[model samples]
Target: MRYMSHLLPLSRVARLVGQPRSTIQRMIHDGELDTFDGMVDMNELLRVFPDVRWEDDGEFRRVEEIKEKAFARRVYERALPGKEVLAERLHELGREFAAAKSLLLHYDRVHRFLDDKLDDLAERAGVDAVATLRHWLRTELEAAPDEAARAEALLAQESVMRIMSATVTVRPSGHEFFVEGNDTILEAALRAGIPLNYGCSNGNCGECRARLLSGQVSKSHPHDYVLKESEKADGVILMCSYTAVSDVVVEAGVAGAEDIPVQRVQTRVKAVERLNEHMVALRLTTPRSRRLRFLAGQHVTASIGGDAGEYHVASCPCDDRQLTLHVRRDNRPFARRVFEDLRKEDTVDIEGPGGRFVFSLESRRSPVFIAWEDGFAPIKSLIEHAMSLEISEAMHLYWIAAAVDAGGADHYRDNLCRSWADAYDNFFYTPLSADDGLATLVERVLAAHANLSRVDLYVAAPRPLLDAIREAALARGLALRGWHGEVIEPFPGAPATG
Candidate 1:
């Protein structure tokens, strides 16, 4: 399940696609992307995105907010039942929903979901104000007819038209720029040397996204998307949208970058050696011969021809002068070029020491429970970092590999943990045969560590395995939120698993 990779951080990828982190994980699991090495690049992202170019279109999306002045007024007015009666109904609704998680799960009608949720709650609680709400809205909404009329007039304002513009802003590095006439924020940001977080340019991801600082705007935000009340609370806006209003200032974060730290950089193919029958070690030497500065567990990105990808630094962390990556060939993406055509003398591009997986012995909190399902690269790097930081926590790695290659798991465990002799806690890899079949393995992990109280668990694997681990951990009363993972998921895809 592992492959040689290019170094593209999960965050930037998420931003580019306008999706939460979990969605990308699911896509990778479902094998919906082109994973050259272990990373998918801009070219690949756009290729997979069927209508990426449409993001550049100037025609505004059909959202109620296109005339937001009146629309918000309408919503605000409708939401305003008599304050006393509204409060009474809201209180009753709370009690009903609190007791009826079952009923909430079954409600299916979409357009009337809000009405259903609230109405069900009112009827269950036998609240009389529920009926009053209709009469109250009928009476109140009439007062906003003039405001709606005014909004209709203002929405047709000719001074405004959503034109595409690229915007870039760099952080911690202090770089910033804006595209004057171009409406493509992704293009503008990249053109200007700004790295803002973005995944899908189609407004599906909330990453290359930013806040609309000044001008008013509108989009199909009604479709359930990433920006929640908190992120939007700070004036956050998506960079992908053709602005409902142009001439707006955007506070750029790294996902929306003028130059993704992952873009091409010249690197030399230092060497290629065998790690095992299934894995090969590929060494890359940067052309400048200077050490690439990066935090301990971050990865690097590389590409070949006009289309290269990224992967983690498989070599020791202390040495950034040259890069080492482990390539695991897959049946789908066989590595013919990298192994056969690539040469030692030629230069290649590797950008980043990417990813947020880092370790420090400076603050030892508890024993480290490290689990890697084909995620050996980052997990391996982190374990090394923990050793370097002189962390006192007892570390355990439940590393997974094919059953036969289990004996060869060495390089990572030297002077590392309770056991130097390689009797590692190895988990058998089984093909998922049916539903609830593999949940047993995850349950076993928790059962053994029942007293693993206060442990920091780091899990990296396929989406299904991760989901099983999450469910098991929660079942065993593992307080995940405090130790909650930085992973993302597309909940809509959850039901599709069956």
Candidate 2:
């Protein structure tokens, strides 16, 4: 392999070093592995694989580097006679003292070595070769101290060090700045004097979401809450999970992390059959290790091939390990590729394991209020999660939906409805088209359940209903906070406004 010097694929090198393939590719783009073009194979990668692992993908190396640089900056600050400069920091941070460093030897082993040589050659040797210049220098003068110093200074001055850098765009808040760059977007933002909004810098908190109007960014952490492919093309990104891959522009308003939950890839579409003219009951499957972790009634954004706005996850956050999503297709909204044409084995991109609608038996209230409409997707998850925790207290549920068709493979609803009817306080059903049945969403739940905010009130339905029920509960002076509702499209931006 060493003798061949070429032909090694990057995936193989990634395996040898125990890293993700994406990491290896990022390092190459960051100029860390600038030795090759795009692909790194047997001979080419083997050359640099020994000393460095995955440069972009390395968690430990990045942190340590940040620490070392911080130390260097501190030393630079103390050593400065007056104003601090980056050069002063570099000089103070030298690990070894004055060891006659050779410029040729220093640049030879780096990925940028060849590129530097070519660029410098273009400027100095476009018409004359270095050999001819050296011959002239030897004949013209002997080794002069001033000339040698001048030559070394020029060479040193022309060297490029920083590889992945970021810029910033200040948001309307004026206090917070949106970060964009190729490698470390947030890091670069901090360097540029921007107060980047962050809570739990890890990808778990969906606080760092921002729109990238231009340029590219890479994830600083591995993430399951990936934006839809269409959203990516449209420039929406999760700042926490992304490291700018190139120069980028964005809206930098940090959505409060506590308000959002990170979506994890837990299951696949196991069963899909129609429940009504506009609804489909989807049973999703998942492995034990990748089980979902979320509260009941919380929902997720589900998309195929990254087209966001496909649909929302109707699953219990508590039972997320092996999750479920009951999709009531607005035939109009998901009429295209993601929902209608999506099939088994197709990858689904999800975001938001969100919504505050949860029923905790621990509360003084025994019965949790559940308003189910259109379908069983969202409501079933909440009920199941509540029962899993043995909240034996009655679940006073008002199942509100239109069963427009009985022949459209609506068999799944029978088992789901029967399973919970015997287990809780009361199961109320209402038909959408019927005059007496569908009109009283908030009114019905209020009639049967207590009005105190202490009672967990859950509403999962169309956006119109969600807003109506939410407003009614709050207007009654019953602190209807901790309200959890499931909507179809992701509420754009990190702001709590939407």
Candidate 3:
């Protein structure tokens, strides 16, 4: 589905709402908002966030000013026939501008040189005017090489001739950006001043993944991230890693208002309670006016004493001012400080709402959440958000983790899972230990489910485990469309693989 669009980038829209650019990007990807040439429509923005005060509020006054300027520019541009027509007109105008300037400069230089020669010849030659004229013409001819060099240099300095080897048209937005012969799609979009949703600027994160609706593209770099076979068949390409070999049509989505903008907030440690020997619950409170607004399953980076690390938010979005995270004790600097030195009322820097592991609020499919150890943090948030929506579809959670201690058979927060399952008619929970082979467990669980393809599966685990389960599920005829997962960073003390 497509929505009406304006020419304002997502950043401007995010700035108006005091949110992160990623929030708006997520909305577009989730089909909540529409964009044209990387911009959102004003009417659509007002419709999406009707609560925003445009008439009386000081912030919105600035937004209105921006809107007026943008609309005026759009009106002037729309007077032209079309983008291609405008592009051709601009190319012609540019050539004319360059040619005119070059002509003036060339004439001025030649005239000065000839004028000096004529003055010199007039003074030197008394009677032979034709001879003097001949001498001057010879001098001008001799300087031709120098004139040619100057003209070449001037033309080189002008970027009026852009040889676009390929053009990328993103649809159904009707936005077009050009690609240089040697540049990747992401680089070309950025160079052409086109806004695209991306992260890391490398292929490892898969944040810039998009579908190639037509044309050819080739890999330009090696990416550590793996793409599923189904995704390949659907023409998915990592924008950061692929260069267009021909005029390509790609489909990339934009985000919406429900995605809370990410920001750096000053938070005070409200409490830190040890959940177990290896895990702790960290609660934080942000300033009243600067509270965070994030979707469930998003992450935040906590920084203190020159240390920072990303952790998933374990709390629900309903509790905006207050934050919660489940931290696993590790040798990493951030975790070490949180475990040994962190205290209540201590100030900390929290930057967040990162990651796209968010729950799709619009999806009606039954959700199956899978988590490994403390990776359950985001899953907890997702479950709470799903409950808040009062969704009618059944939701199930399968938590797999190492036993807390030797000879201990219980999983992390087993009692809570059992309580939730008992309390809610639509919710179910299963706890599994890592000792149970991942493949075996996945097979058993998937077999228990009736429609594997119709379920929305969200997983949070180490990359290897997530990959294993994904392959196993696919083998069981699970659809790849609704799969989502967060790759947990390895612990500091874990064995390093070369």
Candidate 4:
């Protein structure tokens, strides 16, 4: 017997099955699962994940526990949708349930009418064939279909998901993310590592405006900027002020490195964490009204107490309001200031998030990162961004630093790297000593991969080593465009070596 088809977006399907989006995509790629117009049929989802217990609350609880532990108290609270948005979402879901119930009631009435007609015909015709047909219809109607229980459970779980989050799809870029808790479209996009253009996240600037293509959204926050009447009639909305009530398609521009204008933000020092004797992690928190926007692997000029220096951001852009930079003990005035006297709550002026050494958003190839000495700063940012993006390709990291006792650039965040490797099945970490001559280190790294053509390699090192690795990698079949290198000077006055 044929059943009604319920189509779900891939993101929702992944959540329902308790799997990563990449896993679902892989299933589709391998022909293990089927999709129509990028959506999975409910029956197809049931067929592929037969063992899933949609009625079980185990998965839901597990996820909640992880979030509770992973995020700070304030952050966890912020992740929840505002009461206004939550109420609207619930109201929308109720309307859907009401409509479905009405349709079911109509179908029941039709079934009864057909049954009465069958009886009338049987009584009038007085034929054995008519009686048999009537009996068959009654049996089929009275008995439950084999998939009834599973289908009901699926619907129940989906209702909960709808109440908790909504999916959003950006046109042109085709990036998808869940609007969970109380996030506006812009907030969710940034958290998902999709760098959509925006300025003054509180809605003073009209930079985050986009045209809504489908689905419903409620204004979760008020904005001072007014939309033109024509623009409003054309379905234009400011992403920062609107919360999606259902799966939505929007026409918004995804900003590239060049597309992101330089932003000057006044930030306050949150903390100064000494990673090791040689390096300190400067944590700065931006004002609630304005956050600095920059891509992974980008460097920003930060000035504190009249001393300014350029440093690669060590934190992910997904880290809202907070920015972290790694500074080494050197003669640079800014570096010295951070080590000598920078304290909590001190004001820092940040400007010009310059440099093009950023993640290649378009590529799905496995990323191989090589960091020399203190060059791990940018590499760390890129890895975190990759994790946030949830890329399916395997990631390999190589940190070449001196031994802790040797006093060279030690792996200050070694434990953090180890935790990532332990947590993710697709992430791999390898730490090598700089003592292993640059040539030998290159050979060792190259030997790990038999084929380099399919991988995107990012290297951060002094110019000489960077050029050497690039030449060797290209000769070994690495795509020329896939090579990204950033020069790391040993000290402030050192001449850049090519």
Among all candidates shown, the one with the greatest TM-score:
4
Q: Against the true structure, what is every candidate's RMSD?
A: 24.1, 23.3, 22.0, 3.3
Output the lDDT of residue 446, model 3: 81
Ranking by TM-score: 4, 3, 2, 1
Better of 2 and 4 by TM-score: 4
Residue-by-residue lDDT tens digits, candidate 4, 338-435: 99999999999999789999999889788999998779999999999998887878899999887545656688899999999998888999998777
Worst 10 residues of 3 by lDDT: 154-163
Model 2 spans with C-alpha error above 4 angstroms: 1-267, 287-289, 310-312, 317-320, 331-341, 360-362, 368-372, 403-415, 424-434, 437-442, 450-454, 467-477, 481-498
lDDT of 1 by residue, 319-377 (tens): 43566765654431224456556677666667775666454322334434433332556
Which ranges of candidate 1 are over 4 A from the true structure?
1-264, 287-289, 331-334, 360-363, 367-373, 404-437, 481-498
Model 4 worst lDDT run, 10 consecutive residues: 489-498
How close is every model to the real structure, measured as TM-score?
Answer: 0.38, 0.39, 0.48, 0.91
Global lDDT of each candidate: 0.47, 0.47, 0.68, 0.87
Residue pair clashes in candidate 4 = 80-181, 80-182, 81-181, 81-182
Residue-by-residue lDDT tens digits, candidate 2, 115-162: 456557757767556556645544544445543443333223211121
**Runs of candidate 3 exceeding 4 Å displacement:** 1-260, 406-410, 490-498
Q: Could you tell me the lDDT of residue 214 within candidate 2?
A: 56
Tens digits of lDDT, candidate 3, 1-498: 222232344544554555545456667868888876566776566557656433343334434554567547654332222334335435655775698789879978987787677777776775478566767666765565533443343232222212124557776654455555455787666544344556555678787889999877777666888999999999999998887655578997533323345788889999998887778889999886466656678898998868888889998765646789888887678888889999999988999778888876556578999887777889998888776544557889998776656322135577888898997777999887666676676776687787777788899877877887788777776777778878976433332111
